[model samples]
Target: MKKSTLTQDNIWMKEPEEHDFPAAQDYLELLLVPDAAKKIVEDLKKAPTIIKKSKDILRASRLPLLPETNIHVKENLKKVQKNKKLSPILLMRGQNDLIIADGYHRLCCSYYLTEDMDVPCRLV
Candidate 1:
């Protein structure tokens, strides 16, 4: 599959200068079904795995990432490429958006590596 044009430089990839934990929390509350939200949080508290899914599917979702965060992702990607296990991305099934609660940078990095990459994620 062709790679998505979406990247750190993309307009949709813009993020607040400061990490907005509260806003993210509020958005989750607003977007998720109560039980589903709770289940994800609970799952986060437990073990997470690197489940591979198509990068094209994720690109269609149109979730954004922080450019600054991408720097870290690049560094981590090097380690991942070297056989290190990075944490699973936290995703939420929202009514209108495929919300990425965490690990947008990792997703972007994986996209950079290969468009058809079976990117790893922890879906809720």
Candidate 2:
């Protein structure tokens, strides 16, 4: 009987594909310990995914002059304004949320270079 923290509760019961590991499968069939059962659920909760937005963004800085290539700036601005309530100002982050990993210039341009617009951002 193999015992692992991941088998605490029947957490494995909820997620079957996770038992690709031979040891976890063995735990399911032969070894059923109370402590290990609880740990499995905690591990599942910690399993990371594309992280969600953890905080609200701030839009206070001034925008910049529009570039010749930004012909669609006006249209984008209208789209942002139309859905102002539903959409949130996009921001990128590093380890801590709100750390702008990219889009510094583009975001600045959107606000200053063109009319106010909602900008999308991706953080790593």
- The RMSD of every model to the true structure, in order and in angstroms, is 9.4, 20.2
What is the per-residue lDDT of model 2 for residues 1-124, given as tens digits with 9 covering 90 to 100?
1122212121111222332223332332343354553344334334432322212232322223455356454444444344321121222232343433223333433444223233333222
Candidate 1 stretches greater than 4 Å from native: 1-39, 43-54, 64-69
Q: Give the TM-score comparing model 1 with the true structure, all chains together.
A: 0.54
Model 2 misses residue 116 by how many Å? 3.8
Q: Evaluate all candidate structures by whole-model CA lDDT and list the values in order.
A: 0.53, 0.31
TM-score of each: 0.54, 0.24
5-109, model 1: which lDDT tens digit per residue?
322222122222223333344556776776766566666444344455537536556855434346676776665545544444666666676777766676676
lDDT of 1 at 23: 36
Q: How accurate is candidate 1 locally (lDDT)?
A: 0.53
Residue 77, model 1: lDDT of 60
Question: What would you estimate as the lDDT of candidate 2?
Answer: 0.31
| Pairs clashing within candidate 1 | none
Q: Pick the candidate with the highest TM-score.
A: 1
